[model samples]
Target: MSGERSRTDRTTLLARNDLVFIDFDGTISVTDTGIAVIDALELDEAWEIEHQWRRGEIDSMECLTRQWGMVDLARGAVYRMIDSFELDEGFNELAEAAIQIGAGLVVVSDGLDFYVDRMLGRLGWETCPGEEVIKRPRRCIPRFANHGRVTDHGVEISFPHRSPDCDQCGNCKTAHLQRLRAHFSRVIYIGDGHSDLCAARFADLVFAKDALAEDFAQSGRPFVNFETLAEVNEVLLAPRTR
Candidate 1:
């Protein structure tokens, strides 16, 4: 919960060989920011668009592009709505623990980077704008997500992180995981939705909940079940019995 820690201090303590990739919406935040935006702005058509994405009828890029096009609210109103949402109570604990344990923590989300950066900023985690993190290395909690710009007309969305070979997700969480995994000895993934399924499969350790947990359970894949970030922190920082 200590937001006063400097980025340099935290980065100095980070271990280069270990990393944790987390989902944003339902994992770190108590609610899904995208859905909240749609509902708050009364973008009724966006719901059907979401349903299409859920049914696998459209890729997330098209889905989000369509939904964002439907947005007619003022930029300030949209940002105000985003600021109203709350993060998981235990997220700060998990983040602090990750720094304490020298494990790198990054958020890889399929949602908008605008909101993601705002949310992380609320926790005092410094962030680099847009795809700048990819070009410049920083000691902050890096985020990968679809890019969004608020215009007088509405919100314009773009996919700067989507995989060249894949169209299913806007940000392509799997691609980010694959790239980061090479530099880390162990990679841990924490998520709760469909966007997480692909990346979670490639992780060295997975902590799953909600749809992600259901999918892994149905497939008989191994994963640790968790209900809160606190539980994740406990497991990660616990004394090894072995």
Candidate 2:
């Protein structure tokens, strides 16, 4: 079902008890971190697999598994490359406002935990210092994503959050939001890709961009179009009728 908008035009009322679910890849960062890692490692065949997934010929699990396998770079090398990634300049402002407002912030992604944790840590989102024993955070705004580990042979990819019922995605964002539904009165979602589709539908409010925006447009769901965190904060901080 589509969401009801707040009294203010083009704004939504987010309460203090609301929980915000954010997508990490293309949404927060300028580019898809997973795709950037794949490209950096010169995994040319991964593109073909991605195209197959987009064309509805392959599922997301297969696409991710095959793509990770094609990545032959050493664990250290991979981290070095990922460290160079850049985030949207306005993300910190949005984050600060959310924190100040006492809203829960969570990162839900279909990408690898290693990259997600690393990138978030670079932005000072770590749960605690020296707690990244496995090269991934204990929690990233209490995140959920595919787990990644460095092994003797190469990087091992595992999906602890993969839903057994849904074979389409490695991490079922819909399931994640469903679990959080009872804990918060309102759930807000921010995202920018195909993986964000299921979860975005369940959110009380959505801020979308790139492909996710197109998905929202086709779904006829009420959503805010945001190019930066500044725009997101503008809507988030807007006065509520209730």
Candidate 3:
């Protein structure tokens, strides 16, 4: 009886028209990969900029540009730091389940593609049919800067960035989500912490955590609160429909 139910559940999920949007840093992995980058570079002020970004005063790209200019780290060291990070325990299972359900998975994050791609590559989840690598230059680390400013919120610095048109973070999550909206049947976005908030409003169903989760609750944003990705995987296993 249990086996039959399992098969039915998989069939139902597979039959549904759905799309999965995930936030890379904290949601897919154990902690924030973006924060991990700053730590690896020995930059001690990432928290202040992070707070400002959460407050919506400055855009993520600007925050990242100023924040990363403080890092005195090497390119290899930075990559190694991100590579050492681990994925959320059940993330692989959740991803496989999402794929099995015919639900295309989209990674939308306020993090950089450099670390996002590195982390995703470690897990064997490669590119989709049309995946483009959007490059945003330094002011993001290994780009290096000389001058620094002490701000009311935090210390800020300026650096020459590769993709100036970009917001300055490693990745452009909002842009990706805009594109996702046009392509998917039903979109389910999952995230934790501050950065994920911007993209939350755009998803059909949002599963939130940490500070991001708190904002959803107080602001009356429709979202499901989850402690871990394991719980999220359970929800994904259940039947879903567009």
Candidate 4:
């Protein structure tokens, strides 16, 4: 999760004809998926790196660059571990409700796209990996089908954020939001960790919790408390002008 929109990005996004910004990991899923990834790798020490990043001691790129090196598992091993994650309740319902309102929802995360893809896959959301993750075409699966908000082809999958650190993330949420800013309106940012700070500033409304939640309040910015996707679903379904 991330936000701190430039005046230009914010204006363009808020004026957007039909767009909704979302954060993956904890916001979309029930729990912080990145933490789950670290747990899967048994990198309990990552909590330390995350703490430092939250303290502004380092950026996420540097944090991931240093922490990722500590892992010795292959991508397959990481996959198996994240697969065991328990999704947040009411996610599918939230997605469906947002789409039902004629809103285009996009999830941008500062985490690895591979794990994000797998999680979405289990939810029956089909996605075509953007060029950043796979250099070549992979098999296309059955229509991206989910109990709630399923896209016609698949959700827009884009990642591999550029940077001086450019570390592997569950998703490149910062870059994703930047791209969306070029053509979106009524953006909303949701997240609960250190990775979310930058992009959180860009959102029209921010729903925060945990570190991100605390960060906003301390900074004198207002945000809503969010405990579950169902809580978010309530907000999405609330009538609003586009």
Candidate 5:
């Protein structure tokens, strides 16, 4: 949370028509929570299930469903594991900058909503107490990801945001991006995994790393490469020379 920028600086640099869409898990969080959950629960087969999704052998809904079915841990244990995860150091600063500049910031993920909700709650991005009482009320960031519920048997996954026609992704980031594009003049997408590929293709500007970066590099697609959210904040709030 370093290099804090002033509200005036952000307002001057950031575009009012820009809508920033960020991916959770590896992009914001230090580790991918879905993989973390599988590892924490000692579900060895889940890795293969994920690989199947990566290879296009299975859709994300089946991938998550099959993987979660292997989890035998209690609900409390799962939640504790999720709570142990950490977000990128600069995430809070970036989020604050977006708010200050009056830019729409939405977190779109292919991961489960359970961990997304827990991680965002750490930053007070879930829900504020009351906007009337607070001077600058925090905006509750919207999340689009698959739903997960821990039960006595195992974790049950449901896709409330899934595209009726597309089976490639459970949450369908591309569909969400298309829907948001109607409202915003420009869309800036930040992500680091295979799940972000479809959405990145449709974004006005893309900040990529990890697998998504590699994919864009191989395809010769235009994108800004970044290893940290600090870099993203720097680019977004950098003073215009022109």
Candidate 6:
């Protein structure tokens, strides 16, 4: 991190310093872990809620809140099921690249902190209460997202960083990115879903895939199309021609 550099010299400024924000659900993991849980449990009600959110009948916060009630299975059972899911093969490489470059990396996801924390822990990184993990270099990669608690009734969700102005996402990614922009000269966002659209707009650069790529295309927002963390690493860690 350094003094603010004018956006006019963005090519040079962004080359050396940037804060990278990544999404978890589909970006880091191969698929959405939450949906994987629903499928594993065969919770029909959860599917209906997801459909509602997709069809614009309800917001993501509402959809997730309601869906949690349908997950009546025990915590251990759900954890075992979700463990079958896989992470993006290049996540470690990307993380290591970010660390080497002295760039700030934060996994700002809308997914529940429970799975996020589990995944981070499995990657050998220590996590904090809010799923925050700092693997040396004196930079923070906190998992700013919703949280879930399993109980006898079902899973209960808490939106710790819900946006006061927007109800679309449980943990609004745009708000988190804006806060990061205050300190970082360039904000690089990577994502692959509807929940990431707003934050994508706020980012200086975006690596998008699936529905998110289409959203950026339709809206005429420039972004790099990528399907793997390898692609992201190649671009971010490459030598800047400018």
* Candidate whose TM-score is highest: 5
lDDT of each: 0.78, 0.75, 0.59, 0.57, 0.77, 0.74
Candidate 6 residue pairs in clash (backbone atoms < 3 Å):
none
lDDT tens per residue, model 4, 1-242: 23333333323222224445556667766677656656766787888997887676776556655565566555556556667887764666655544445445555556555566678778866555332111111232211111111133222233244543335343445556566655545567767876777777777678788878988988888676777866655554543422
1-242 per-residue lDDT for model 6 (tens digits): 22223334435222435787889999998999878878777887888888888877898888988877777777777677667898886777766666666677788777788788788667665445323333324433456879887665667898888889777888888887776677667888889987888788888778899989998888777777888987776666654421
Residue-level lDDT tens digits of model 1 in 1-242: 12123323432233446778889998998878888888787888899999999889999999989988887878888788889998986777766666665667788889988888889889877766433333323447777889999887788998888789787998998888887676667888899998898889998778899999998889888777888887776566543310
Worst 10 residues of 1 by lDDT: 1-10
Off by over 4 Å in 2: 1-13, 127-140, 238-242
What TM-score would each prediction reach against the true structure? 0.86, 0.85, 0.71, 0.68, 0.86, 0.85
How far is 65's C-alpha from truth in model 5 (Å)? Answer: 0.6
lDDT of 5 by residue, 1-242 (tens): 12233434543255766788889989999888888887777778899999999999999889888887887878787777788887897888877776676667778887888778888888766732211111223457667778888786667889888787677999888888787777667888899998998889998778889999999889888777888988777777754321
Candidate 3 lDDT over 56-141, as tens digits, reads 77876677776665655555655566678988766677666654555566565555555555666777655332232112111111
Count of clashes, each model:
1, 0, 7, 26, 0, 0
Rank by TM-score (best first): 5, 1, 6, 2, 3, 4
Candidate 5: lDDT over CA atoms?
0.77
Error of 2 at 219 (Å): 2.8
Which number leads on lDDT? 1
Candidate 2 lDDT over 130-216, as tens digits, reads 212112222345677888886545678887877877878888888878877776678899999989987898888899998889988
Instruction: Give Cα distance to truth, residue 114, candidate 3, Å.
Output: 1.7
TM-score of 5: 0.86
